[model samples]
Target: MTGAIGKPTPYIDAVQKVTGQAMYADDYKFPNMVYVSCLRSTESHAKIKSLELKKAEASPGVVAIVTGKDIPVPFGVLSISRDETAMAIEKVRYQGEIVAAVAAETIEAAEAGVKLINVEYEPLTEFFTPQDSLKTCTPDEQIHAHTKDHKNIHKTAELRFNEPEKELETAKHKQTGNFKFAGVTHGFTEPHSAVAMWNGDETLTIISATQVPHYLQKNLSKVLGLPLHKIQVKKPVLGGGFGGKSDPFPHEMIVSFLSKKIKRPVKCTFSREEVFITHHGRHPTEINMSLSCDDGGKITALDADIIIDGGAYGSFGVVTSYYNGVLLQGPYLIDKFGFRTRRTYTNKHQCGAMRGHG
Candidate 1:
C-alpha cells in the first residue's frame, strides 16, 4: 500500500500503444476472410418500397448479401427498451440507417457491391426537434411504434422531494433560466470495426473495438438465435470510446450474422463519416430551470423541466433522462427539489452516454 498510495502511475498498455504493437480489432486477419459493406438509408423517415439486390448478388467477388430480414431481432443496452435492430426492416427512422450489407473477397469489392444494390423509399413526415416529437402524430407518422399516446415520446422520468415548485413561486429571491444544448459526438480517434468468425464447432467468435463486450455478446446471441455459451466476444485494443463505443452497434451484428450465414470470417470497418453516423453520443437537451434562495444566499429550492432528443432509437436514453435532472441535486444544500425529464424520439442519429453520461 505504501508504494501504490501516492505514486504517479502510468497506463498498463502505454508502451505497447506507443510502439504500434497493439492489435486493434481491424488489425486481425484470417484465412478466407471476407469484407463487408453496408447500404444505408438516404431518407430520414421512410418505408422501404422496394429493394433490388440482383445486381449486387451477381457482382464480382461478392460472396453474399444480407438484409434486415436475415436478422430481425431487436436489442438495446437497456433491458426495458430493446428497440434497435441490426438493420432497418420495413421502414427506416433515420438517415444513414443500415438497410443491407454485402460481403465479398475484398473491401473494394464489398463497397462496389453495396453501390449496385437499388432501394426505393416512401418518405414520411420527419421530426427533427424535441418539441416536434412531443406533439401527437398519427401512428403511421410516429418514429417508433412502441411510443404511446400517438406521440414520439420515448420515456418520461420524474422525481420530486418536498414539492420544490411551490417554494419556487413564493421565494423572495428566485432565478429562472432556459437553456439549450446541441448534440455532441465523442470524436474518438478509432473508427468502429468488427470481425466475426464462424468456428468449426458451429460456434461464433467476434473481435471488436467496443467498450461493452458483455452487452455486445448478449445482443449478438439474441439477434443470431444462438446460445450465450456458443458465442464469444473479444475486445481488442480500443483507440478511444468516451462512451461512444459502448452500444452494441449494427455493424457488429451484421458481420456476425454474415459470417454465420456464409460459414466464413467477415469483417467490417467504418470510415470517419460512418463512424459519425453510427455513434450514440450526448443527447441534445433543452432545460427550463428555476432556483430559489433565501436572503442569506442559502439555496432553498430547485426545479427543472428538461426535454432531450433521443433520436431514432432508445440507446441508454431512459437512464440519461433521469440523470439530466437528478445530477442537479448536488453541490448545494437544497431542501426542496423536483425535476421532470422527457426523452423524445426524433428522425436523427441516436444519442446515449458520453464522457460524463447525461
Candidate 2:
C-alpha cells in the first residue's frame, strides 16, 4: 500500500477515450432511429389550461408526440418523494419543465415539431426564495399538494444530541455567524444524452450517460409499465457526472417512452442550454450557526439553522436535508450539538447531489 501511494495510476479506459474509440450514448445509432425534442414550459408557475399538438403532429417528418398522460407515473431518486412526472402533468412548477415531447425522423424535424405545439397556462403565485417558501400559501399556490400546512417546505430535518442552545447561552466564549451561499451547477464536459431501443421481443434497451443505472432501470419500469427483467439499461462512456447525473432524469424516460410508442430507436441529446436547465447541483443555502468553547479551548456546544432552496421537484432533497445537518457531527466531538434543516421548494431548476453529498 505504501509503495502504490505515490504511483500514478492511469484510468483503465484512458487510451480508448483519448483515441476517440469510446462509444458514448449519442454515438450509438440504429437503422430506424428517431430523434426527440421536448416542449418546455415558459411560465415559472402555472396550471396548464390547454395543450394543442395538432400542428406539431402535422409538422414535417414528425412521427409521434407524447404528453404527461402517456407516461403518467411519477418517479424520483428517493421512493419517499416521487413527485416528478416525465413531462409536466396538471401544472408546471418551473419555467423549463417539459410539457410535451416530439419524435421525428431527424433532430431538426423534432425541434421544429416542438416549436409548433401550443400550450395555454393560467399563471399561479410563484415562490422564488426560501424565505417566501417558508410561509404558508393557499392550497392552489403550494408547489406540491403533499407539503405540510400549505407551505412549500419539502423536508425538515432536526437532530439534537444535548441542550446546545442552553449551553451556548451560558458559555463565556461563543461565536455566531450567518452565511448565504449561491447555487452552483456541475457544468460537466458533455451535455446529457440517451438512446432507447424497443426490441422485437417486447424488451426495452436504453443506453444513457448516467451514473445510476439501477435507479434508472427501476424508474423506467415504473413509468413505462414494464417488468424489471424486460428492461436493460446500459452505461456508455460518460463525459462527467460529479454526482449531477445520479438521478433518473425526465429526458431519459422521454426517449424511452417514445421508442416504445413507435417501436423504433429513439435518441435525445440535450443542447448546452438544456444542460443548464436540467441542473441537479449544489443547493443555494442560508445558514445561521452558533458555537461555544470553554477556557480550555475544547468545543462545548454547537447549533445551526439551515435553509436550502430545493427548486421545483423533490429529487434527492429529503436525503440532502438530513445530510446538511448530520454532516456537521463529524471531525469533532461536541457533546452538545443540535441542528435543523428546512428544504424549501422554489420556482427554478431543481437542486440535488453534487461533488459534496449535500
Global lDDT of each candidate: 0.94, 0.94
- Per-candidate TM-score against the hidden true structure: 0.98, 0.98
lDDT of 2 by residue, 1-358 (tens): 4688879987899899999999988899999899999999999999999999999999999999999988899999999989999999889999999999999999999999999999999999999999999998999999999999999999999999889999999999999999898899999998899999999999999999999999999999999889999999999999999988999999999999988889999999999889999999999999899989999999999999999999998999999999988887679989999999999999999999998787
Error of 2 at 314 (Å): 0.9
Q: What is the per-residue lDDT of model 1 for residues 1-358, given as tens digits with 9 covering 90 to 100? A: 4679788888899999999999999999999999999999999999999999999999999999999988899999998999999999999999999999999999999999999999999999999999999899999999988889999999999999999989988999999999999889999999999999999999999999999999999999898889999999999999999999999999999999999989999999999999999869999999999999989999899999999999999999999999999998767768899999999999999999998888
Give the TM-score comparing model 1 with the true structure, all chains together: 0.98
